[model samples]
Target: MVGGGALVRKPASPVGPLALLHRPVPEPPSSLRRGPLREGAWRSPLRSERTATLLGMWVGVAFAVCFATGLLSHLIQNPPSWFGWPSRPVNLYRVTQGLHVISGFAAIPLLLAKLWTVYPKLFEWPPVRSLLHAIGRLSLLVLVGSAIFQLVTGVLNVARWYVVMPFFFTTAHYWTAWIAIGAILVHVGSKLAIIRIGLSEPAAAEPPAAAVAGGLTRRSFLTAVAATSGVVALTTAGQTVPALSGITVFGQRDPRLGLQGLPVNKSAASAGVLETAVDPTHRITLDGPRPQQLSLAVLRSLPQHTVRLPITCVEGWSATADWTGIRMADLLDMMGLPEDAEVTVESLQESGLYRASVLAPPHSRDPLTLLALRLNGADLHIDHGYPARLIAPNRPGVLQTKWVSRVRAL
Candidate 1:
């Protein structure tokens, strides 16, 4: 008997051979026969394989998008020898990182629905039917655990609530993403047949378990879940999509609210560089074959060029502004560095994970890359990296390296 004392008919086995050798099946342990394991503990007709399968498909797709975009982001920040990120299509990082965050948010509802639909399975009796079944269940645990971790950490990171997280957000999130995606693939491969059956048209005589009179029909439930996902995406996407800013109740940053018509993730005060940035003795040292120290006055006097660029943050907000500064190529030329030289840009901020960033040859030589001195036709705001800051196309906001101190060829 299964749930609700319903008699479960068993298929007859061949009895002509080896009948006497077949041993009687053992009874399940007391631990497996109580609470949720009780015969009628879960009676919800809505918890069907079909509904679970549908929700699972959508969750998988959302995770796929997040994985792709997130991996791209990690690689760009920590590029390998063969990986070369493009410098063109200035808004490329903006769009991709935005989609990464939006998709992660959208997955929350779908993931919850999927878990609700299949939650009863977590209490299945005879949990380890075989070695293969044990392996499958283990994968499910990894899938659910890592998926939850990714979403929770992602949301916290966006909210800038790092105190609650015990581990380093970026490193933990990046590595666990691999585990989540791998488990998802294993789960999908194991459930291929069931997925196909669930997605297909129902048979004429199929039971109407999900058609409970007072509760939500399966179609209605699915529609509600999808609508919730859509709502989440729309509300939070204003961080990246300027058109929806008015309705963005949960966005981390307002594109229109910040220093010089742009959002500031890290201010000069927060970075502990306020006094250092304003000090008259400050000079950006360029260390290469021909070392030179250029003060703020010298940086401004050296032929200034203005180019429009967007600063895209990993948290998903982006803002574009006209940056006036000396081109990176020009700076490199002044240092007597070759065209393909790699450089490390340092900040005046005393300490932080991103106080310094290495600029690869492509970005170092790119004409659009600048050691910015002004924003929106005025001198750089103290919070927006006064004196000088690096502004490069298709680069993350963190890598912009505020409060110019030194640039060294690597």
Candidate 2:
């Protein structure tokens, strides 16, 4: 009688709803019968090798992103704003400049790993020795050399460091980077055949012939990837997380940090004539024949001004430092130089781009700008123009002259 009653009531114990809720949803029947998934459903297994090659080219692609953003940054930073560059009516250089530096910095380990993986292939002999070999060798050399130079300079720039070399890395860095692009183009363009051969038939693609010959395998490659990523993560955490900075197991030469510093001139006198004297006797001659040395102490004693200015470089990089020094306008006032007269900042370093002197316009008199003597709440490093340097808001680092001994107001 109970069973008959349950059937009559359609089993209304909520069991059916609960069963419906708990049951797994079935996958929709694929249109692909036994052959393959629909066009988008399943990519051919052959594409795996192609995928690897493309992944391997990621470093080169990163370099391209850096160069484009960096060059774009330079034009925007310019006073006149040439080449249809974005006008900084709202200071857009901040975004692009950051992209440039971040992109440049991130490329460090990517490039290293990519190079390590592909370098072995360079020794592979051509089936037929000819121009391809010569071209490939030359392209590899240019790519590797350019990449090293670019990344080294890039990482140091992020650290707010400089050497007694080129101040206008924007012009020189951009110029060389463009050359790098050309080299990369040749590298890619020349290797299209080989890349195509490997990638065209991903299904047919097996272990890279060279890698197999060298006893490398996908498993080994994966292990290397895991190791590289771990190191990078540790490196990143140490930098961003102050807590981890204490447990720096790695030495000072952080792989992620790249080279520790820029080239500095030890012979260049670190002691400036300005630092040696006191306030009363010190006189700053500006817009005059020469800078009348004034007591920077006196300038400090008057009113302490602080502008946290970030020096952005055209090479797609930037660094922030607390700028503390006499205002360019005040210096002009002290020197009795005309407000309109242009003051040229000459670095101890030679020009890497042009033959003639690079000049910062008279607009440097802006109150926000100052001759910086300190960085990050401390004394400037010798590697970073020890005694004095120029700090301007949003100007490329090259324009921020280092090892600045002479500020002639002409």
Candidate 2 lDDT over residue span 59-148, tens digit each: 677788788877666564443533443212223454565556555665676677666556435534331244434555666778788777
lDDT of 2: 0.53
TM-score of structure candidate 2: 0.52
Model 1 per-residue lDDT tens digits across residues 159-240: 8999999999999999999999998998898899888968784523233755475776777788899999999999989999
C-alpha lDDT (0 to 100) for residue 38 of candidate 2:
38
Error of 2 at 183 (Å): 2.0
Runs off by more than 4 Å, candidate 2 = 1-52, 65-109, 112-138, 145-179, 193-280, 288-304, 311-326, 330-341, 346-365, 371-389, 396-406
Q: Which ten residues in a row have the lowest lDDT in candidate 2?
A: 251-260
Give the best candidate by TM-score: 1
